[model samples]
Target: MSAFADDTAKDEWKFTLKNAYINRNFENENLKDTGSWSQAASLFYNSRMVDTPLTITDKPLKIGVDASVQYAVRLSSDKHVADTVLPFDRETQSQAPDYLKHGATLKLGYDKTLLSVGELWLDLPVTAVDASRQLLTSYWGTNLKSQLTDQLYAEIGRVEKVSPRNAEDFQKFSFTSNGKTEYSDGLNYIDLRYQVMPSLKAEYYFGNMQDLYNKHYLGLDHSFNTENFTLGSKFKYFNAKEDGNNFNIDAQNIGLLETLKVNNHTFGLGYQQIIGESAYPLPDGFLPETYFINWNATGFFKKDEKSYHFIYGYNFKDYIPGFNAAVKYVYGDSFKTADGKENNESESNIILNYAFQQPFLKGLALQYIRIDYNVEHGNDFGEDRLFVNYTKRF
Candidate 1:
């Protein structure tokens, strides 16, 4: 909550504060209440690395030093609704919810690109933060992002360490799943996007999880207007296979979504397929990362499975200019056991979001969500999430 700048410099000093409150209850009458608060400070300065005018970025010589801290607050709440929500394990609370630094980044910018070295943050679909959690995920490594042209862009990086959203300490990056697997030296990733037309674009992503797996993703998206209606369609294909000496993981995933938007109303339909002998793995832990965003409550990825969902969204912008809401219902079928038995599951989610447009609260936002899951074998549950955030640039 403080700052200082050089007397003769144009550098901008920045600070940020965020807070969120979460309450989750289960079908078994289990209730938990918690809150997370975060703060950050940084100095964006000029670097003399290149004396030439900018050719690729906003400034010819820009550098920055940024750091962030966070705290997790566990509120006193009853967890005896029915007590079946989850087994309480004192051994699991190995670390106290204390004040801790989550991010520290050294950034350099030139031309139209910027590179960051040291601890950083990622928000990709597969290796991203679990926003429902109290804190954000942080990674340690180097990243380079550049705007190559008006219609093209690229991001490349190598991250060897990670401090998950809910973890107290950093851990070596690796693929985490239902089974314990050896950690790797981290992961490598690159993403490229090209605008094929004014309203159509394509994106490709690549990731190598050390010797465990390598993943490839290709997606195409397009949106256009017809009269007062907006129509959009998105398609993505994914491939993950064993890499190096690893032979226990392999999978193929496909996703398709179509949407129609009119005024403040929007409708969407989505389909996803999972093919292969093994389930696809995303990073996980108390501080996990996952992205195969096909459903409201789960990834819906199972051996020989196909999933579908429909979504409805409304934006009060036309009515209130800063409010929006959405709901989605998802179903998964054709799950197969090793012997090929049939299993099924269903999920649904309700969400509401709003951002304040008033001058004093211009950067404030609030969101609420609920997700329900029903599976065979008499297992059914629901999760509720609430988030409040505020951000600003100075």
Candidate 2:
């Protein structure tokens, strides 16, 4: 008995002493446990990109898989519209083959140190804060994040590719058909975030977007809480340099909200603007993360243009167990356009959602979208989308 006890003590002592003298760097940390897994799928109907001809109706299937080690895969397939034909085709364009994306990753960490390598979807340091679309695709990149303090963190990495389908395993994938231009190697970004107060944060980022251009962003967010109402503001600025002498490309957006609990209705008003080009591009599009809500009308947010948006939501706890619904509206005009000249387009959306108390089924949502465009100003694109989604997470 004494010998067995002595042996156990010796093993514990050895382990404690070994760990005490270990000199481990962040990148050399031993691989530990594998991560979790997540899967999501959705079905939708649209009038534009998904349905090329704008004639025959089509339904698209989109599926996604994400696992530990930052591995992710996305697959998409769709039926063709029977009424529309390509330029040379006498019949409707044949259905395109399913698109696939596969990604993989590895991470090492020690104490407050961290190192990541692989393709994975990340929304830290650089991302839209309130983007909540269930079927929306995510960005992929290899980033290293270090926890500088409890309230601050920093990250830098190369975005080898930007596809929601295959996140981390893009090493052998090439965007160009000829395989000459390696798109992944051409993208890089660095960003930081710090929490000034319990409810305020400041963020900054600098990066280049392959052949498109170079850009930087700065933003500040703050929230104030009182006994009856909560007030907050999101302010941001962007500077982009086009390869050649383009118009001074600069854009900014400011959103302010005030919320009070009176009865069961919540009312909020938002305003967003585009100062430079036709619109500020992040995620390479004009969809501002600020004015993203169903029912808000967003006219083409062009240079010198300002938009006013409004939102209303209601929580019905007694009617459907647990449910909430919202609606929004937006309107805008180009600042530099003459009174008779055409400007950008306008948009509106409405959404309704319900959540269940069951364990497996968390929530379900439905959405309707409408876009009215102005072709006279070279902004002739217009379309509509009807969508419904269900999500379950474990």
Considering every candidate listed, which one attains the maximal lDDT?
1
Best-matching candidate per TM-score: 1
What's each prediction's clash count? 5, 17
lDDT of 1 by residue, 153-232 (tens): 88999988877655656788666555566677878999899999999999999988888788898889999888899999
What is the C-alpha lDDT profile of model 2 across 1-394, one tens digit per residue?
1121121222110000000000111122342211111233432211111112222234222111223221112122222322111111227533222223334445444334445565455653233322232123334556676777878878887765444321212332122211233332445778888999999998888776555446677777788777766666666666655422322334543334444444567776766666654445444221234422222323344566666666677778767766777666566665655454646444444455554567665455444444443333443333343334453322
Candidate 1, after superposition: displacement of residue 338 in Å? 6.8
List TM-scores for all candidates, in order.
Answer: 0.81, 0.61
Q: What lDDT does the true structure give each of the candidates?
A: 0.67, 0.44
The residue ranges of model 1 lying beyond 4 angstroms of the native Cα positions read 1-24, 28-61, 77-95, 286-295, 318-321, 337-341
